[model samples]
Target: MSTETLIEPPLQDADALIADMGGRARAAAKIMATAPTAKKAEGLRAAAAQLRGQADAILDANARDMTAGEANGLTSAMLDRLRLDAGRLGGIADAVEAIAALPDPVGAEVDRAERPNGLVLRRVRVPLGVIGIIYESRPNVTADAAALGLMSGNAVILRGGSEAVRSNRAIHAALAAGLSEAGLPAEAVQLVPTQDRAAVGALLRAQGLVDIIIPRGGKGLVARVQDEARVPVLAHLDGICHTYIDAAADPDTAVALAVNAKMRRTGICGATETILIDRAYAAPRAIVDALVAAGCEVRGDTDIAALSPHVTPASATDWDCEYLDAIVSIAAVDGVAGALAHIDAHSSRHTDAIVTEDAAAADRFLAEVDSAIVMHNASTQFADGGEFGLGAEIGIATGRLHARGPVALEGLTTYKWLVHGTGQTRP
Candidate 1:
């Protein structure tokens, strides 16, 4: 092994790079602040076309990143996230094109009221200025985040993981070309140039430069960004999602939904991590068999493990885990109350759903559960922005105030009060 810094050509200085990005982004944010809807739409349309045109270049860059990732000992799941196929590339373009179709959120009226003093008050939506995104392995995020940020009239600076640096740079270049073609500010969507760790440090401390910092990845990376960043952060810590089968639930429906929830795209944040089964009506034998058939290893409580030799005995730790893989954690609860308590103790407050024919149970769970997205008789996978009809999303926000649930265009903007009076001053 060579005795050198892990990152090639170790970057000891971040001051110049940070300052350049900061000035450029701040200037871009100003232009976006007052950009007309037609202009922004044109930019998005141009970007989508350019992305499609540069498909071959993007693929080549992705191949290089994938090769390096394998040499660096990245896991299979990580590699899957890093790699992009033709369909995925098309989807990314489609998303940008779709964003062009959405209504311009900027300058929309939030609320209007008529006062007794003959004054009219209006609240209008406005962009949040510059956004800094720090993500891991997922190069698609470079396109997704940039599209969302630009559409909402905010400049963005993306910091992708080192493993996908080359791919991100190529994507960034294509986007920059689009902005230039449209006569828009090219720095509207900039990518951090180097893979040095100090760059992250500089980004975290750029309070004046960045309006918000969004972290998308595992819990550890998000936590670190949140802790270190001086700017405000929008983040999802962990998607410890869940699905509960109520006592009055249909066995067939439960078995099918549960199997699909855990097995379909298990690496996503929306996938079911823990399953709550109502002991009163669960067809434990048949359900366990279905899960096994779907290639999931079951870890359950003593009673559940005793029901079939297929299940392994689960410990207390199993109740509070988000296994983003084929492994599932199971528990048999007394009823809705017991299930809620279990979820409350372990959930990451991201997404949770219940499959039940009983209206009362469904209503109670929907009202009481504190997760961002609560579903009734639906798959937990629907917690995504695209599935929720947002067309695209930067990431789900687990934070409770101001913005919650699937973050979309409306969530990206803030409101300001506008008042007009016919020669009427403060009375």
Candidate 2:
């Protein structure tokens, strides 16, 4: 067994702890960046085979975690994320194998240009070097982070929530074993050994050692990382997503999409939290009735409350909340502009959808919504990596720059400049 403590006890000195991880990861990432694609793929394939072979052990570990988590009063949503069944374990194995089959993003040239002054320039993809990931109770992240990091040629240091520390450790061990067997540096993917909150502080400030930090969890954790991390971060914040039923929307499509968006799976980040109804044809009553009939607790303005007794009076704060549950907030808007106004003001800029039949309205909403993913006549719940044809995702990037929407293998990579010249010199 490795001497590394995959999950350390909670400590007050988070910075020192994170710095240690950052340093190790930086060294490992340097080596990985130079590794050949065939070698990396072999490592991944070995890891997948190992995962399949150890399915029973993984299940046992996951069960122990679930038992402990439940006894400690974890919520249903948290428990769901923590649980691992045979199907889930198989899926994890499949993900590993799928990643191995993908084309390596690293070293791919993105752009090339030649200047008149005998200067040649080319932009090629390179590993970010080291990645620090802080996430909540989903132990599967251990695998996801490892796959993405290796495929993109970056070293990763993972810090999972204390709730699933044991499970995370076991999974990390499996990955390390695979790397070692493949003759790769095991440090290419290191799991922070402590549950220490201080470790997060260290990772955030490991400016030179850790290239970027990615936080994937609740709003509180995302906020903390964003605020404290000295390193650049690809933050996956709350999915306070919205679904606007436009004036010209088809009622059948709107009802079906809204129901699925809000009620299909409420605890996911991409589940729709707010529903905006265009008042041209649909009244507050009509929309509320349809939504409540589908088991949604509609909270809205006075008009909505009057329309359906099921709707309670909504506070201003309700507009901005990401209710990752069966509850929903509702509103009646005048037109497309009104819908866009509300979304712009209160959206988390994660994912939003407009259910409309009119091509013009769909175009307008798609162009205007500043969200990462905007859907027309579809559910906001569709804003998932798997839904987008990528096997899975690291998280969703609401930020506009380096990455946006679903963070998949491609999102995990960045470009570098490469040049080839025949003894060319700038005069």
Candidate 3:
């Protein structure tokens, strides 16, 4: 699809290829760690420019991926994630530029304190070195990962899904060109050239070479990386997100938000897969009808079935399913407590939202959801790094240790102690 001619070196061995890339990435990370903030920003901006300038070529490449996806029987949701047009391309470019505009997270002081003995210590942010990203289908991740990784002063090794290899290559080239324009090493943002699954194994086993691995695809992929990688991983397990319509929720707003959360780009990890309506809520039928009108199939309990024949009975598995499609499971809950309990049991701790005018209920739900992102009076789709103003995200980290929610520039970094002492050692 991309008409641009690319001459790739022959693949010798998966291990050898990974070793070479990992070594280069390690070296690149060292340089990126100390690179000036302005230079990093310049690289991001240049990549954004390249992305915008090469929109047509990128779209053509995406078309090829879409065709293949359909032939391979990819679901409509998966196909949507893989497909990209001029508008989405422009949005990706804009996200890169936004990353360029954000203040550099590196060197930011977390805290500083002076001891009585005159020893000054502070924790400061630093890049996490080389990041290995294994994602699926979405070609835009090539640009997003490069921009976020570079801005945070880290070199990245990207291994996108085989489904979008052609598109990823094209996008990677554009990003590489931008990095070169800014005098940054193109190797700083390397795309694994081959589609061999062995490469993933090699990368996962490359513990020292890669500082950390971030997986941005499905559960199977994440589970494989989590199970196999000796290196630390930042993973998003599932997006069994939910939207609860509280009794105090405005009927019109709840209906609109419910429809948007479930149907607006349903293929995304942020899309709400479940809707919980409070039993006291008077307009359950209206909310269900709205989602159905938006072409979403509603699988619900008997209460919802009583309102519309279009509603199907929800199975036990439906509660825990991340149906990244125009399908949602609805349940009627007794109150906020019931909604929270159901969410706690079924949610992947990714994101959940509650729509309510009652401040106490909203606050309680927010405090009790136990999710990476808990929103009040909003859609779960807001659970994105770009929307969180981190430019773009490497992934949505559901893990609680290093980072959680949207893993952006800040999340890409870890801090180290900077001690200023004049030979005041503890003797």
Candidate 4:
């Protein structure tokens, strides 16, 4: 659509293509599991360099994607996720280089013990084998998931959304070429070429071929994966995150935190969807005014609606919505108790935060809120794997299992028992 020649995927049948990818990834994962740390780093660094070198090509591909996306009527939030500029492309490369610098978690010792019979036993981290990362939009995930999987000694199979198909292919081409040039296995990173839906089903059912399936997308994609996949899944559901401004909150700080948490980047998962202002807060009206003034459409409860004529009366569903847009839902609560009650009922257990100078209240909220990532006096926008310094994230795992919160390198690995013994047997 942008007059850039679109790169087509391999024209194999969906099931056969996915099967081939799974098998290739499994073979590559076996080799990668024991690869020296330097080699993995080499592969990542090469990929980063390629990302920068091929910037023009990738941008052209993304331009085509943008035109198609607009024609297809994709949401503004999704288009934002799909759009790629030079700066964002460079950021992706930088994240890859940062990942390359990370200490290889593979083969790192987790714990050690010695038996009375002098049998030394230790547990060490290992790859999760082949990682099937199925993500929607955000073409940068094509690079992040590949870099992370390779860094953690697992072969990666990427299946990105149809909306950003060209963008994903362009980025993956750079990665594959770079990794191959670095002498990594050719199959180290495989991109499912087709945009067919059947490929998703195949990947979901490839239990043995794919060690783990991480679905990073909307509710429909995640729900389908969770329900149909026979393989283990790392689910990242809706980011129904909340930010509560306590009665003891500093007025200026509350305004700043609330603004940044919601309006900084409305499309991000970290953006606060619900803002709970304590009725006794020094200036609750100021916070509402700030959000409204920032071009944000504020949906408010009855009290908040009275404070600003611009405020739309919030519906009951507004509290539970993840409005990945310039819209926000605001409500005034009695205190921390009421704030906590609302969050407890509506939170998707992704991330929640409290803003208060009262250390006692902060401590209580920090300890009491049962979400995966909880913060005190900080913006929920900080809920990112890159911000958390793990390089980049596959996704925030809301499900309480193998990992939780911005999942990164450490989360990508599992542990295995290693025994160093002198022929000690059961006596």
Candidates' C-alpha lDDT: 0.87, 0.84, 0.91, 0.91
Residues 71-146 of candidate 1: C-alpha lDDT, one tens digit per residue:
8888776888899888998899899888878888999998899999978999999988889999999888898888
RMSD of each: 2.4, 3.5, 2.2, 1.6
Please, what are the lDDT tens digits per residue for candidate 4 over residues 1-427?
5434345655557767778888889899999999999999999999999999999999998999999888878889889999999999999999999999998999899999998899899999999999988999899999999999999999999999988888899899999988898999969899987777888998899877898999998889999999999999998889999999998898889999999999898888999999998888878789888998898999999988999889999999999999899999999998888988998899999999999999999998998888989999899999999999899989999888999999999999999998999987886
Give RMSD (Å) of candidate 2 vs. truth: 3.5
lDDT of 2: 0.84
Q: List the residue pairs that clash in candidate 4.
A: none
User: Of the pair 2 and 3, which is ahead by lDDT?
Assistant: 3
User: Candidates ranked by lDDT, best first?
Assistant: 4, 3, 1, 2
Instruction: Specify the highest-TM-score model's number.
Output: 4
User: Runs in model 4 with CA error above 4 Å?
Assistant: 1-13
Full ranking by TM-score: 4, 3, 1, 2
lDDT of 1 at 112: 96
How well does each candidate superpose onto the true structure, as a TM-score?
Answer: 0.95, 0.92, 0.96, 0.97
- Number of colliding residue pairs in each model: 0, 11, 0, 0
lDDT of 2 by residue, 1-427 (tens): 2122334344757767667767777888888888999999999888887887877778877877887887788887788888888898889878888888788888888888897765689998888788888999998889988988888898999989987887888788888888899999888899887776777777788888988899999988999998998889998677999999888888777778888999888878899999998878463465667778887788987756777668899999999998777789988888889999999999999999988888999999999999999999888888987788776678899998899998877888888777777786555
Please report how far candidate 1 places residue 234 from its true position, in Å. 1.0
